[model samples]
Target: MLAKRALSIVGGLAVIGWPFAVWLVISYAELHILLPILALCFVLRLCTLRGKTGALSRAFKGLAIAGAVLSVASIWMREAQLLLWYPVVVNGVMLALFGSSLFSSMSIVERLARLHEGNLPPAGVRYTRRVTQVWCVFFIINGSVSLFTCLAGNVHWWTLWNGMISYLLMGLLFACEWLIRIRVKRRYE
Candidate 1:
């Protein structure tokens, strides 16, 4: 179980990190190398998801795969506009999953924990829901703004500002989730 959880975390990081790494590397080299690497990572990640049989997981998987495909397609399309749409597509799907789970009768966090392990405390569930809600809101707002900026074709200094702000917000949300999870674990212990 511990190994599975660790693998999931590592896999999630790779799914998120590989594209950014490719982008960073391409910053110093040719753009052509970026697409193939990004596509490979995306495809590899999509191939590795397991126990994602639930509706929410399936939806997330679909959206994530679609977003990755669209991102690569955008490169070929030569449309920076599609880059903005990428976040919107991925984040929108995540928001929908969170929103639906928030209203469900089942404990979403518990379900997620069970997916990783066997059982989790009620406090853990509450903390998970709260943190996931915040993450959903973060993605929705930033994603919408990014999509709008892309549509407007505004490549200004504020664009960098937007990217930085979004990154900071996500980082803070991730930290808060970790903190809440730790607090819940300590309380139970």
Candidate 2:
């Protein structure tokens, strides 16, 4: 159990720190070494997903598989350039997951809101759905920028966007959402 928890923590960090890892490793080490380490991260992520079954779980598993596939491709081709696309792929997968949730009866945000509120009123449901839509839009735009970074092939620029600027934008969005949610919640109360 202890080992599992540790692995889970490491896997989560790997996923979140992927671009940074790429930047750091490729700076001092070889792509060959990073590829295997990245593959291990994906495998660890997959192992952590064991026993989870749902759309969200499947989405996460798919992400790990995609990362592993990229790792394999980079290794096979001996092309470190392929490693640059990892962030783009990540954004695409997230876009798909969150975008697909919009078509379901409950939007992803609605489901999350339900977890805490238990019985979200109709207004809350609508709000969550709108929030989910906003997230979908965010993914589309963010993914586009990531693709641009991949295409540009400038490691410094790519790392700056994917590792720092992207995260900052996401944090800003999250903060705005929280503030909006507070205002919206007060309306329901």
Candidate 3:
């Protein structure tokens, strides 16, 4: 579990950092070589099949990995801009996952909360669903922004938004949600 988490962290940083690094000192060719390997190495988990994850989820992951590989192969100096869509693809997949969960018995956030609390209260269930909805909307907006930046044809904006600003906004969202969760828990308790 630790190894998988570590691999994911490293791979995520590499993907998000690649654009900035490319604009700075890293060669685009070097990034192309590293990106696909990182995708397969850290993105594809052999253990994912063992989990209760849906086949559709697994298929989505496979598609992302394949897309990453194809992007690497097709990438050239002029076409390097195509790499900007990587985040959009990622967020789109996440949006699907979260959005689908909303229709299920329990939202994904509720499942994660249950892992810690074991049994969620009525209020908790409602809160989790709201949180899950928030995440779905966030992914949609984030993906849209990613697509817009790419289409705008500015590498600096693409690199800055995808590499730095997006992460910051995500962190802020997570922190704000966590704080809200605490307040909700207190009210329920």
Candidate 4:
């Protein structure tokens, strides 16, 4: 269990740091060379997952499989450009996942919030739904930008946007949402 958690943390950091790693250190397009290795790691990680199969869990599995397949294809074809498409595919998948949650029985944010807060007040439910919608829109826009950067064929631009700018924007959103959530909780209380 500890090893699995450690691996999960490392994988998350690697994904987060990939753009920076590619841009600054591995600027020679050697990043794509690691795809196959990463795919194997992903396979190992997926095999370790143990839980009830829910929609969210299934979606995560789908993403893991997709990443593994993309990595394998990049290796087989020896095309570095395919690596550029990774963020686009990821963002698109996220857009779909968050968008679908809006109309489902529980919004993704609500589901997460419930884990801490128990059954939400009516206002809390409404707030989570709106927050989920905001996330869906953010994903759509972020994915579009990712697609544009991939097609633009500029490594520097892709690195800057996907690596730095996107993360900054996401952090800003998270901060703003957290501030708002405090207010929301106070109002409900």
Candidate 5:
């Protein structure tokens, strides 16, 4: 158990650090080398997942599998361009997961909100659904930008956007939603 936990932590860090690693090492290393290392990270993540069949868990598993496949394809085709597409894939998968949840009985945000407040009022449900919709829009915009960066063929720009700017944009969205959530909570109360 301890070993698994340690591996999980390492895998998590490697997955999160991928963009920085690419930025720092791509000059020194070959794309094939980096791609296999990424594949290893995905396999470790897949092995470490909790034994849940919820939509969130399934989404995680799907992401790991997709990441591994992308890495393998990059290696097989001997094309570094495929490596840059990882961020786009990440956004596409996220959009699918969150977008599909909108049609389900509960939006993903509603399910998460319920974890904090056991029974959400009607207004809260509407708020959560709206938040989910916003997330879908964010994913679409982010993914399109990521695709643009990947195709632009400027490695530095790709690294900056994928490694730094995209994260900042996500944080901005999260912060805005949090502030909005406070207002929402007050209104419902």
Candidate 6:
């Protein structure tokens, strides 16, 4: 359990740090060694995957790894104009999958709740579903806006703003999930 939690923390850090790392590498023209470091981090992350969470985490990590490689290569080859948009595309794809899974999982949860006559209150279930749906929408909107900002060649501050907004929404989503879980537990007790 400790190992799983640690892996989760590390994975979260990797995801959040990746963009800033890329920006640093580009700004400092340190492509040679930083690229290899990024690749090594990706490999380490790949070695940590063990189950369903691992599988999904690995998928995103792989996308990030590939994007890092492509970004470095593009810069090295003087093709920044083309490869600059790679991260945007990768992030968009990841968000789409993440959003879809939230919707699907919520549907399954609701279906299972329906199996019992005196199951969870309808309002509670609806609240859970609605919260998840809002989260899905948040992911989609954050991803879309980030991609647009990246593609538009805006200043670095734009990306920072996108990151801040995404992280804020994610924090709220986590809080909502925790509250829902507490409610569910209370219902059973």
Q: Highest TM-score: which candidate?
A: 2
User: Could you give candidate 1's per-residue lDDT for residues 1-189 as a string of tens digits?
Assistant: 676666556547645554354344334445655555555555555655665677776875686577577657857775434444555576677777777788886445557777886766676667667766776777678778766765665544224534456667778877877776777787788
Q: What lDDT does the true structure give each of the candidates?
A: 0.62, 0.85, 0.70, 0.77, 0.84, 0.59
The superposed Cα distance between candidate 2 and the true structure at residue 151, in angstroms, equals 0.6
Candidate 3 has its poorest 10 consecutive residues by lDDT at 41-50
In model 2, the Cα lDDT at residue 47 comes to 92
**How far is 169's C-alpha from truth in model 1 (Å)?**
2.2
Candidate 4 lDDT by residue in tens digits, 61-179:
66667666766776788765666777887787788888898888999999989989999988999999999999988998999998999888888999999998999999999999999
Residue-level lDDT tens digits of model 2 in 1-189: 998999899889888888877776556555468778888888998899989998788888988888788877877887767777887877788888888888889998898889898999899999999999998899899889989988887788889998899899999999999999999999889
lDDT ranking, high to low: 2, 5, 4, 3, 1, 6
Best by lDDT: 2
lDDT of 5 by residue, 1-189 (tens): 998998789777866787776665445554346778888888888888868588888888888887788778867886656667778888998999999999899999999999998999999999999999999999999899889988897778888888889899999999999999999899778
Candidate 2 vs. truth: CA RMSD? Answer: 1.5
Candidate 1 stretches greater than 4 Å from native: 1-30, 50-52, 55-57, 113-128, 152-164, 180-189
Q: Enumerate residue pairs that collide in model 5.
A: none
**Model 5 error, position 122 (Å):** 0.6
Q: Candidate 6 deviates by what RMSD? A: 5.3
| Candidate 3 lDDT over residue span 46-78, tens digit each | 333335365355745554474455456444343
Which model is ahead, 2 or 6, in terms of TM-score? 2
TM-score of each: 0.64, 0.94, 0.77, 0.89, 0.90, 0.64
lDDT of 6 by residue, 1-189 (tens): 787677666655765666666566556664545655655555455455644463355666666566556755764775444434544665566666555655564443354345553466666677556654665576577667777777677637544744466677778877977787778668766
Q: Report residue 33 deviation for candidate 1 (angstroms).
A: 4.7
Compared with the true structure, model 2 gives a TM-score of: 0.94
Tell me each candidate's RMSD, in Å, in order: 5.2, 1.5, 3.7, 2.2, 1.9, 5.3
Which residue segments of model 4 deviate by more than 4 Å? 21-32, 50-52
Q: Distance (Å) between predicted and true CA of 128, model 2? A: 0.4
